[model samples]
Target: MDHFLGIFVVANCYRNGIGVVRSLQNANYWYQKERDKQLVATRELPYNVDNGLKNMLLENKYRLSWIPYNEFKNIEKIGEGGFATVYYAVWDNKYLDADIPAALKIIHRSKKYSEKDYSEQFIKELKAYCDIGYDNPSFLECYGVTMDDVSKEYIIVMRHALEGCLRKNLSSVAMMGWQNKLTLLLCIISDLKTIHSKKYYSSRFT
Candidate 1:
């Protein structure tokens, strides 16, 4: 766990200070103003990451590798989040004759998000990752997309972080010196500043 994730998980909170996000409204707006706005802002939390990325790949003419589930070997559950489950797997690259370790994020369908809603959300998130990918080394590097055969759910394949999330290693950070903590916070602030400028916001940042 590192301070960088402090922003990684909630970088979108920067949307408020930036004019980048295009706000969408629904009929529910009449009953609840503030709450409805928040709902509209985050109506789709990307538990379903594939459908959106698929469309994006087509629209943008971008090609993201599609690896079948069977190619992932020794899959083991590592962690679970509100919207997705994380797994540790080794990607067997047939052409390269190499095994690549990766983290697979499998999004779970929720009662709150239908296919349309979640698909849009997943696309938004994938776009955000693209924005931060190579240009910003601090973010997770997404390799490709895959699916869980049994669940028919999509998975995001990315570089595995052996250290896990910062929350998992908070104790170590708490023991660090003031200068170090400040430096970490500075990194998070810098990342957040970038997210904000991109006109994206993650309501999960609180």
Candidate 2:
């Protein structure tokens, strides 16, 4: 069982005297133990200035498992950025269960970039995604990372926006009334507030 769940069970036992004497102190101790476990897990992440990128990726919960580049089928180039190109692909989840209709972000190994320059940008983007994490409607869910054997490029697996970007959706739709616009703006603001409230800062695109 997951350690978090185990910790909850222990706390519950202490609270109701299921197997142990009912004591508020004991219940709180078990809860604190779980909190300490999480802190220890976090501390396990490497954080050296010289190896910042790799160290950040060491937190495997968000770092993800390796998938061969060939596993993704029907890849269609959707967009491009200064450092990476994005694609929509069908992910093969034979090894590990994962979501389908995923977005594949491939890094551009440009001649203009030195090893350090390319890695720094890639790491920055990856760290941002890991910080956002899973199960939030406002942010894209990042599944994992993979490497292209042929191209030798790093790939970031993420959730695909089926309707395309927010800018595209807004332009494609008919003119909206003030009420509709206000509703959309409010929703966006709410999501932003949630992100800001968290200790981890998220750099998100709609």
Candidate 3:
């Protein structure tokens, strides 16, 4: 009787083991299905605000005026220069198929200039940029140009640079070893050579 009871107990343990194995298999299958569903949902979702802005500009053929500046809502002032102040802006890009990320350099109107002078200078600057062409990526990319009807001020739309400027980088180089400084100087000279070549070509032909 003891031998028979021991055999029955072993059989019961084996059945329980089989039940646990089946339960584990079902759980793994459901987990995999849920993971796949999540991935598909993520792909279908709208792009983030920054990407949307970029897509909108690209899809609109880099036309700055078409972009609603108010919608972008300035994040911060990036830089200020002699002629204008640049602000970092973020916006939605629902118009674009790919929904690319974007940034805008908001150019503020010069306070020093009269309305007439502002108009003239704005046109002159626009012409200079247009004539120079966008061949060099180092050169700021101008996307759009517009003048405010009320302020009679010019705004140039440009691609935003998160890494800041060459001037700031140069300051960092000043603290570096002499070898690095020399290398940087050589690079600067190379850039100057390219600029000079472009100027020569422009003068010679057009």
Candidate 4:
């Protein structure tokens, strides 16, 4: 219980710019603290943890290996969303055997959002991502989340999509013959069926 609440406490600190200078890294660090403590307790428990719970935790546990901000180099702004700006960055993964090209989505420094609002939104979005899980073929792979030490801001790390958005692929779309386009459309429709049946969002091709 302490560790669970500690996650939020650290998050609150980041949201309010209390002692932490509003760092997502600090908040993420505490979130992992709770997860690590829980994992330890689970291993020590006498009874078996339910397979469902175990799988769920397993799916989300990669956050424990949050990448450090300094590891990213040559960040190029790629896109922007309602709440965040996206960048393509080169990441040197200390834990992994090789370097990875990645995408970073940094939350906008909003003037209108209060600390509480930002904190709540952060938790909500993070939870959504965690619930979605990894290993889905249709979605971009997420590396993890981290914060810039100098900026005191959080950024989400994801596998970079070098081909760019579907709109950029429209020229190829126009070049395709009717049969090929039909096959592509049929495939998309099939994927859409799966997505709808699962009630999940995912990226797909036209």
Candidate 5:
């Protein structure tokens, strides 16, 4: 199996034009030697694969369908604040084939709060996100929520930002030219205006 894998890797590298021609030549030479050894062993041994190997292959297949959190496979941790940790994850949209990315915010269920309070806060956050809407592309969009099976922790998922957070971008303001600073200011103002409008509308309705 290792020999077969080596040959596959070499073939893939060759096809993809990975590295220079000389590197590919060396890989192909080594791969050919391994393949010859495998061919010689084929007649001597009975093909009996262990259950562990089979299980590993199955796990890999499952992982290819969806990204795992612990492995940090497709998700990248980009930001964190008092309330939540943010990750830039590939949004599957519940489809195995979908490769679109999105931002996922994980809000920890505070041990200090009661279950009722936690639920209420979750709802409020959802409402706030909805009220804000997707007016500005810079504004994060809430995609969905999920719960951890064992821990029973709730997580809020949102759209991933390719450019990252405002706080981080502001760190090197001196390096930024006037036009860039103006653009950043505009985005901040737009976000604040949306929040203010929502606050006023909600207050009047209440």
Candidate 6:
């Protein structure tokens, strides 16, 4: 019954067809799976991303939304990357003013990065929203964290950028008048200033 750019929840994702939800809930799951304990033969790996996020939330390091798994429906896989897969979903949660469309960055568990690395990277990106200072108009609003019970992976629920990222809109941007281009430049510059003001710098390409 959700409506987002004409995208409706035809059916709930992570439901029966997904098989992930039920599989995760098997009793004594963690206790039985000392399989993971064996992975940490030497150093203690960072506890799962779920715990890391919860601890950060408690410390008030960054304000993040914690959306329950049940709140999401009609999850549609939209894209994939080396680290995570992106999804479009309808989020209906009590904390939200209203149900809204959201983009879910579901971090993959086993890939190029180990569980610890993925957890760190996941938290890092989410914290960037706060580091850039959410008060600034240019920062993408990070709604909060959602967990995929089946895979035990963390999903970042963020405000969906409908036109895709700025780079994707460049062709149309080129057609705009000088005034519009100038405005866009100012927004980007202003954001950079905000980051620099916080004494943060990045050499990341993007």
Clashing residue pairs in all predictions, respectively, total: 4, 0, 5, 0, 3, 0
Task: Show where candidate 4 strays beyond 4 Å.
Answer: 1-64, 135-137, 176-206
C-alpha RMSD between model 3 and the true structure: 22.3
lDDT of 4 by residue, 91-147 (tens): 876544346677887875578977556655655555455444322222344556667
Instruction: Please list the C-alpha lDDT of all candidates, in the order they appear.
Output: 0.58, 0.61, 0.42, 0.56, 0.49, 0.58
Q: Give each model a TM-score.
A: 0.60, 0.58, 0.45, 0.56, 0.52, 0.62
Error of 1 at 47 (Å): 21
| TM match of model 5 to true structure | 0.52
lDDT score, residue 140, model 2?
54
lDDT of 3: 0.42
Which residue pairs of candidate 3 clash?
51-100, 51-101, 52-92, 52-93, 54-102
Best by lDDT: 2
lDDT of 6 by residue, 84-158 (tens): 788988787553235677799987776667767877887887777666644442344466677787887888777
1-206, model 1: which lDDT tens digit per residue? 23323333333223111233311112112112221121111122234445556565544332345667888999999888788888999888564455767799887767788777766666665667656643443445666667688887777777676556667667878998885676556655766776777776765542
lDDT for each residue of candidate 5 in 1-206, tens digit (9 for 90 to 100): 45454554564454233443423345445444433432211111112322332232234321111123332238678877777777777654332233445666666678899766766666566556644643332244454454444555555655455467545555676687785566446555655787787772322210
Residue 142 lDDT in model 2?
A: 64
Pitting candidate 1 against candidate 4, the one with the higher TM-score is: 1
Worst 10 residues of 5 by lDDT: 38-47
After TM-score superposition, the amount by which residue 182's alpha carbon in candidate 6 deviates from its true location, in angstroms, is: 1.1
Candidate 6 or 3, higher lDDT: 6
Shift of residue 133 alpha carbon in model 1, Å: 1.7
Stretches > 4 Å off in candidate 1? 1-52, 58-63, 111-113, 171-186, 202-206
Q: Looking at model 6, which ten-residue stretch has the lowest summed lDDT?
A: 7-16
